[model samples]
Target: MKLTKTLTSLLLAGTMMLPGAAMAETTLNFVSWQVGEKGYGDWWNAVIAEFEATHPDVKIDFTLVPRDGYTDAMITQFAAGAPPDIVHLTSFEYQTFADNGWLEDLGPWIEKSGMDLDGWAGQGACVWKGTTNCIMLLYFGYIMAYNEQLLEEGGVAVPTTWDEYLAAARATTFDRDGDGIKDVYGTGVHLATANSSYTNDVLIYVLSAGGRWTNKDGQVTINTPETIEGINRWRTIVEEELTPMGMVGGDIDQLFMEGKVALRIQGPWINGFVQRAEPGIKEHLKYAASPLQPPLGGSSNVITLASETPQEKKELAWEFIQLATSQKFQELYSELGASPAPRPGAVNEAAFAAVPHMQLLIDATNAASAAGVDRIPTGLEAQNNEFAKVAAEEFQRMLIEKLPTEETAAAIQAEAEMLQ
Candidate 1:
């Protein structure tokens, strides 16, 4: 009777364990490239804390990879089948991952999340083909960083037209003290970092000149006359004493902060850095629209995001993203001087009113957002980077050395084809 009773208890215990006694824990690993202090990772940490507190059943492990060699680490992790549940995909690398089928489709999650992305351009950056592939969490517009004092000193009005922009660049440029050396430059070009975004920015010039980078059918259209015009206009900015070449690395931002350059095209983050890192620089800073149309004609803004992400995480990721970019968070970002998204009517009026010059940035982002156009699958972000380097360097040769326009255009077309 004792042995039978014990056997009965053991059988029951085994049955309970088979059904529900052993509960499994779901843990997610998130990897991002922003590892430095106050980087995106810092903000993500706060967001994760909130998520975990609300959902105690789930666990999240967040890791930030160094910005340098970030991609290599990601590939290694992926190869081992221990890829992080979530990864940060920048506009520069989105295509490569997506094309490889490494990402999960998040369309179902997006449909279920019921998040309102109407005002935000997040959808544009997150969508691939007809499917929504990624969730956009952050956005900032690229605009011309101008020197208010330099414009005032030169008696040059803020330029609105491309022609005027070129003239202003020339007027503001000079060897101020006549030391027989060019002490100041009117404008600057990014030659050092070799970032491919320059191609996108330069494409803005082509767009303003009424040129297209790709056809509606998805073909490269860079060799057209309008493109040639845009490229030539950029060259003039370099050779005609408007903007100078050789401003690479972070030199452009540094020079602009030091008031050596009158105008530069950069993001709002630089503005925030100036406010904290170099307080005096703030007094001279102002925001202006890109000369989309030649000396000053480009008037559009372009914002970029990455689309290669797994579907399962994209929704949750976007939730985190939405929280990060929500109007409330955007207001905080604006206060911190990080260029907030241009949701015009979406901005908090009271908060913006209290922050001086932030309104200008808001206005700039508005213009950029309105003018922002999406470039679909311009090739793998990696390929895009190479093409951009080729284009920027070619333009530099034309601007700095006055290389033949035809030759530069030809080279751009050739290299761009290789990317395709």
Candidate 2:
């Protein structure tokens, strides 16, 4: 009887120990394209460390995907029924994912937590069919970065209007070594169709001219007078030989660093690239808001629907998203990435004080309009890609085939209507 009692006592002790020893732990997978990028990777690691410290039972499994194949990889993973719990998707990809019901609707969580969304730059991109599906982490607006030395040599001040921009470009383009061949161009233009840069660059021109791809009701409005005017203006720049021919976005950056381009329209990432490639050129770099209102640029963090199977895991994923979008993390992101924060007032003033040129980017974001991709209806990723493809082809024709601006605009509009 005593031996039986001792066994019972041992069993009770084992149960007590098991309750504490078998503590449930959750692990979340986070996928991002910025894993090895200079400042971005370090900042993300720091955030993960802090989050892990607070939630000791939770482990974050980070997966780094290269930018070139990131979207395809994410899609493949989702199709395989094993998407990461959290994802960083670009604005262009957000709507498609939300439309397919692949993303979690964050509205209820935000409402329950009473998270304020006011004054968050580029937040409109996260809303799909009146449901918030993502949280914007980075916000960038198009701005013009000029080489001060080139502008000074050409005796031209910074251009603020379309006409002035053309004049400056004309003045800045010339032969430097008297070789009778122009060695430097006034601006670096990207017209390739393999990437989205062509579409984005063209949209900047269209948006600045007060043209839009669609109306508030989502009708096709690409063949408007304003759009034609914008396209014509762009053609004139090329016709005047102000930009190098057949270049892509990466080539533009290279030309700018080599001092072959006097002015280039780019986002905040240019600052980091310039600092790393040509630090000496930093002294001559000056930034200005795009001649007209620029398009918004950035990405957002989203929770995937795969996490919904388990309520606890879903809640934990949401917690991480909240932590990432919190003001503290936003400030850290802006400081380290040199990009503008998604939310206004989330940037550290002292950080910008050291790089005053970045202030122009902040101001531009405040004054910018939504990008073309953001303005389209949800679930139209395929249609959108088709539209971009057609538009890019027509744009290339305008540049190389010398197609008339009206014809190009009409072609794009017809393609857009066909998709509709």
Candidate 3:
């Protein structure tokens, strides 16, 4: 009996040492493209820490899938029915997952928790097939990052309209040190590609001119006069040789960071990149509202619970979602990411102190949300990638061929209609 008792005690001790004895550490597999990004990474780490604090037995295994690989990897995992417990999806691509019913219906949880989603930026995008499938995490309007030294030396006031902006670009596009080569340019654009890398840069032009890629009703409105006007505005800048055309978004960002470019219309990530600008450039970097009202940049990213998530992990995943979308984390997102949170009023004094132009981004997001504007077309939510690609390709063709704005708009309209 003594030997048996000793053996039992040893077994119990060994089991205790092996973990999952008193309380098994339930790990929620989480993956994201932002896990390693500078500001966004910090925000996510803090959120995970806060979640872990409340649920000591829970561990969030955060993994980084680089941006280029993110969408494909996510699609493969979800299609294989082994999606991460915590699914992080981009707004444009979330439709595919939601459409396939790979994401859980979050409505029951919201109702049970009495969560109020009113005026939530990008919330509308989460309503797919009459179910709230995801909680939107990020949305933004374009902000113009400018070089103060370049603007002042160009002898132009800050531009509040496209015309003035053109003037600024013209004045700033000159060679310094008389190198006889035009070394400095006014702007940079990702106009040589198809899809989001090029779409966003061109979309802003259309959206700012009181136009849209598609109306709220999902009609192809690109052929409208407003769209033509916006195209003209963009073309004018290009014709004047104001922008270093054919560069990708990253190259443009790098040029801005090096103080080689005067201005750039960018999303919230710009502030973070600017902070690391090459030596003399960081101090002179300033932000302003893009020339016109920034259209709702729409849902950039969202968090969702996988529909096939294990029953045991469902509540835990929801809890994590709740924590992520909580006001505290939203506020932290604004402060740490230097990006506006989808949650209104997230850009409070605390966030403003840490992030430059917090109020501008917040207010823009709020106004766009209030107006029910989203960069995604109303009818083509599920077909966003296709629609955006068509739009981008047509726009690139127009620029390369120097086609008239009318022709460009017509081409985009015809191609967009095919998607519908």
Candidate 4:
């Protein structure tokens, strides 16, 4: 009797274990630059946790590749024919992957699932080569972060026009304590970093000056009168020493957080750093609308599945994506990410009361979408990285060599046209 009971208990235990073992069979890998980041990381984790709960058998293995190296790392994976199950790409870089067929097209899946994608912010950015290759999940606009105390001391208000902005920068940029050395810089821009970031920041001026990197026809327009005016404005700021020389974005951001820099323009993500700023400085930091018209912002990032992801795994990944795009998560994005969520009507006014600047961010996003602005040059989307480098080099030349703005513009124009 004892032996029979023992065998029966063992069988029950094994049966119980078998179900759980079977349930935990699937593992999906997700890679992104935002993993472990302040707001974006939390949102990603919450969505993944709920997704695993809903689909008991699946686990998401999250990895963080720093933004500076993300493009190369992802390219290496796809080249090896074993990319991550979940692929997250930045706005200007996804087209290269789509062109190479490394991304899974979701048209048939969307049809089968009957997902409603109408009026989705940045939805049009996902359409590549007549197919939906990814979801543009993080379209955003740039905002100006300014030091309230510094502006008060300088006797200036938040600027609402480019000329006013220049005047404000001039007032705040000065040598503190009567020292010959410059102490407080007026603005922070990515000058030495020489990447898409520089392009993005400078283009804010270019667009505001009534110029574009390229026209709708995909020809270089940097040498035009309006464009040169904008380029000269950037030259004026740097030449006048309103901003520090030879600093990358990271250094500049650190300086801004430390209260050494008075004003800076960046995407909504800057809010996260603002919250973590030093106690005395954080309270005085405020956000405002940029003087730049049609802010240099749109389609910041996208999420897609790898073409090499197995069919069953792809189905599971798609479910995870569905959760990410659902209304609940969309609301979470607005609250947690502190930026305008891509979904229409996702932002909560009450939730955004703590960060009053978000109202302007929303307005900026709407204006940019209506203006049809993009960070990457129109015809050079695939070669965006190269274009950025070229522009940065010429910009640095104009700053370092004190080359004439018109000459620098012509150089950028000639080099950019060669990319074709």
Score candidate 1 by lDDT.
Answer: 0.59
Encode model 2's per-residue lDDT on 1-420: one tens digit a residue: 445747755765576687465434679888887775655676789789998999876899988886555677877887676778776777666666666667777888889978788988767767777888777766666678888889988999998887788888998999999999987888866765434556766666676677767665777777899877777776777778898877777677777877888888877766655665565776787778777555534443433334233666777877887887788987887877777777677778855864577677767665654443342333344366557667878787777787778887888788888787
Worst 10 residues of 3 by lDDT: 1-10
lDDT of candidates 1 onward, in order: 0.59, 0.71, 0.80, 0.84
Better structure of 3 and 4 per TM-score: 4
Q: Rank the candidates by TM-score, best first.
A: 4, 3, 2, 1
Collision count for each candidate, in order: 23, 0, 0, 0
Clashing pairs in 4: none
Better of 2 and 3 by lDDT: 3
Q: Ranking by lDDT, best first?
A: 4, 3, 2, 1
Per-prediction TM-score, please? Answer: 0.72, 0.81, 0.88, 0.91
Per-residue C-alpha lDDT of model 1 across residues 358-377, encoded as one tens digit per residue: 56565554564455444332
Query: Which candidate gets the maximum lDDT versus the true structure?
Result: 4
Q: Distance from true position, residue 417, model 2, in Å?
A: 1.8
Ranking 1 against 4 by TM-score, winner: 4
Per-residue lDDT tens digits for candidate 4, residues 1-420, read: 445747755765576687554322579999988887778888899999899888665789999888776788899999999898888898799988988889998898888988778878888878876889888788877878899999988899989899999999999988888879888988977776678888777888888899999987898899999999988787788888889877877678778888888888888888877877989999999988877787878888988898888988898888888889888998888878888788777887644874577788888787887887888778888888888988998898777788888999999899899986
- In terms of TM-score, which candidate is strongest? 4
Off by over 4 Å in 3: 1-14, 17-26, 53-57, 175-183, 294-296, 370-372
